[model samples]
Target chain A: MQTTRTTPSRLAKRAHYDEATIHPILDEALFCTVSFAVDGQPMAIPTAFARKGNKLYIHGSVGSHFIRTIENGAPVCISVMLADGLVLAKSAFHHSVNYRSVVIFANAEKVTDEAECMEALALITDHLIPGRWDDLRPTTASEMRKTTVLVFSLAEASAKLRAGGPSDDPDDENRPTWAGVIPLQTVRQTPVPAPYNNDTPLPDYLINPQNT
Target chain B: MQTTRTTPSRLAKRAHYDEATIHPILDEALFCTVSFAVDGQPMAIPTAFARKGNKLYIHGSVGSHFIRTIENGAPVCISVMLADGLVLAKSAFHHSVNYRSVVIFANAEKVTDEAECMEALALITDHLIPGRWDDLRPTTASEMRKTTVLVFSLAEASAKLRAGGPSDDPDDENRPTWAGVIPLQTVRQTPVPAPYNNDTPLPDYLINPQNT
Candidate 1:
């Protein structure tokens, strides 16, 4: 939905409201930054997140300042960004970044029910490594007690995207500068087994994550 | 400068206050998310940033909603995060991401001086492509008029870093699940030239960025 807050006053052409444009950005991102106020001062903290339908979930230690300070129904902003490339232009003013980013404004709610909390935890784990959650040991009661999970509805969200090459002025086309895009991608390197991993073979899911 | 807000209530050991530990993370990140309140609600917007000494600079169109809403001395929280690896553990609760993140709580100040503003623009351009600014066409007066630059001091900044392999509990060590670190890295791919790029050869600076 295009609420007053979601609409941009400038460069309005890049804003997107549909889930088709927003969901991919959120799911592709391994983590997101949550913004909230304390004493009227805004703060942003980065943490892992997962999405189930239209709800996004984030968790932290029960004793975390962020988890404790954020009350139920408090307004928050969540943002996820994926930098795709560097847009090099002939002029300094035209230089830009090729990126896909999403911003959501919503009220945070604590997940207290045991079943919901457990499901969110599993979703988060599987989001990180698809199918790995089913293979892992079950969560213990102590572990559940130490975590604080928060959920936000993606009702008020918008996405902005910038892609392709630089948009330099026509006059600067003959400039000596090299103008093009240098693509950036998040890639997985060789997995390193733990010292006590017992020489278990690497899982195929980790080798090829769901998104990549 | 370990202030009350900079200290993490949990995992205090992961937080660091020295510039030696914080500066590299700031320099390595191409962009940062700035958090500020509008009508007592928090919002986070991501933008390109460049650091000069202890001051961080970000710029946007003068008419942007983010630029207009922010005042000269409004309290803002800026955060930069780089995901290093994924920690896959034997248990769901132990799954975590290895990352280096910094959060700063500071007041924002606008740059009105012509020389400083020009320098900041160049710094930002070069930060994206180290030597590209010097080779590009100079900025025009109109471009300067259209942009708004803001700066923040790093006095109250702190960085939290988590690295290495999974730290699963001893009881779950013998579980059949694979436990290790799946390293993640942002890498540069083949450059894509603009359709009207005039066939300019790629620069060596882009091939090997300073940090890489």
Candidate 2:
């Protein structure tokens, strides 16, 4: 489903509200900064999230104040970013980043149904590693109760991305100063076995997580 | 110097209030999510930042709401995260990420003085591409007045990190399930020349930013 365009919460010039643009960023990024407020004070917390359809599921301990504030219907802004590179222009005024970012505004409601909660938990797990959820021991009823799951719909969201190159001042283009991008990348590192893993070989999924 | 610990905004178990631990994460991260409120509604925007001593300098156009709200001394939460890897544990309940993150709280004040603004802009530029600022054209007077730089002190902040491996319940350790981390890494990609570049060679800083 295409996300209907809405007025950006901030920079209207950079906002792009559409599912095609939003989903890929959400999928590529492993961490999202969740913003919420209490008593008029705004705060941002970085956490991992998973998206299915239009809903995003984030988990926390049932007792966490951050989780409670979100599940209690407090307005929240969830942002996921894919920072591509730094845009170093001829002038500092024009310096910017080449990034694809989505900021979702929603009132997250708690996932109270046991079955749905379990499904959300599974999505969160598999989102991090495609099939690891099935490889592990089944989650217990007590564990489910101990966890707090909240779902926020992507029904209303906006994405802003800047690409290409520096928008330098025309006059400075002729100057000897070099102007271009210093590209950034995020890739997987070799996995380390926990000291306790007494010779358990690495799994196929992990050794080749990208399915390469 | 060790970062003096400060109070956490939430989830006391994970909060660390020390500049020593905080600065490294901030220095390592390429972007930070800055949260601010308008009419009591919270918003988060991912932007590049530069830290010098105990202050963070973020640049934006003067007319942007995100900048205006922050410069007005409205409460803001600046969050920087270095997501290391995913910790796939025995059970979903213990699933987590190995990350180093810092959340700073402060009322940002505009850097109005022209010299400071120039220095801040240089810090921001060199922070992204070390030494490039000095190589580029010097800041012009018009640019200084048009840009807005906000300084947020790191006096009240918290850092939280979870490294090592997944902290799973000991009972599940014996299960034959494959459990470990699939480490995540962020690296620089080969630079993409802007379409408009007329064969300007990549600068030394762009080719090897760290100067090593």
Candidate 3:
């Protein structure tokens, strides 16, 4: 699973297969694009993901063709990206985004066990927002039956990242244009309470992150 | 190409294939995941993207296998997503991210014409930061030769979005829990000037957005 060949030829240094790099990026990103080949043509779909121990879990209803295709053991690629900032270089050729991304090459297998399926659902919800799972109603037996949870191993994966300011050429040092890093952040705003739900105060966990 | 079938079986109302919805999402996102099948195994990659008219352009060096693979005319899927918020519902099953996403299924074609290629390069630059192309050092003929630009039509793409607060089941409406949307925004912070460049004032475009 640890292979240098997974890195693209253009900038191999930016790519790595270390578990230390790939897991953190996967944990930070709750949404990912899952790609699979359908009759020789590739298709990509956005879905929620959660990393439980060493496996990545994605869920969809059994009525969905996407899940059916995966139930048949089709090869899949799950990609997650966190765009940190826009690296503004003096030269257009060197312009890039500072991001931490992971590309996981694996196949999805159905988790038929009821206990594991419930755990996967909780993990998926918790991954999106911590502590929400503890407060929300537990998964019902019928709901679990309707859902098809697919599990994939994180054994074959690689990550790429470029942090810091723009890496411009020394020759362009005198270029008068401002060269810098405009940091981009995904921020959580004040919660908009749902209607009909009487003045239930926002939990401390969600409120705390908004402050920072 | 705009079809209701593009929507997942779970929530059909949140999906659309209209150009109006799809183009704006592609324009706002700085990065995307490109998925293609290699030897029957799907590979997904995160890369920078630019929207020009109806085509999405992605550039890579000639030395990159990703670009060379596109130069061979392979079917590729480009996926872009903007996670806007985290929707917490009374039930864990309904917890989701308010996201705008587009999935493009198309084949990549190399841009052989120099004029078009140069325009694509500039479009890519300006797409990242408005008014950046005119200010930066001009791209040399040698730089053009080393870079390969691939253009893919967005004619067969679709977009799906969920923008509102949590949609809870009628049964769980009375649950004593906070149900709402914590909006997530990708914000731009103050630019950090490159080390070698002495205190260069931030540009007008970057400055204007930061003020808001």
Runs of candidate 2 exceeding 4 Å displacement: A1-6, A9-13, A209-212, B1-14, B209-212
Q: Per-prediction DockQ, in order?
A: 0.85, 0.63, 0.79
lDDT order, best first, reads 1, 3, 2
Instruction: Please list the residue runs of candidate 3 whose C-alpha ends up more than 4 Å from where it truly belongs after superposition.
Output: A210-212, B3-10, B209-212
TM-score of 1: 0.97
- In terms of docking quality, model 2 is medium
lDDT of 3 by residue, A141-160 (tens): 88777889999999888888
lDDT tens digits, residue span A1-212, model 1: 79999997878899999999999888888889999998889988898899988999988898888888774677999999999998988888888899999999998899989999999988888777778888887788999999999989999999999999999898988776788898888877777888879878777776653323
lDDT of each: 0.87, 0.78, 0.82
TM-score (0 to 1) of chain B, per candidate?
0.96, 0.90, 0.93
**Candidate 1 at residue A92, lDDT?**
85
- Per model, kept true contacts as a fraction are 0.91, 0.70, 0.89
lDDT tens digits, residue span B111-159, model 3? 9999999998998888878788988877999999999999999887888
For the predicted complex of model 3, DockQ is 0.79
What ranking emerges by DockQ with the best candidate at the front?
1, 3, 2
- Candidate 1 chain B, which ten residues in sequence have the lowest lDDT sum? B203-212
Greater-TM-score candidate between 2 and 3: 3
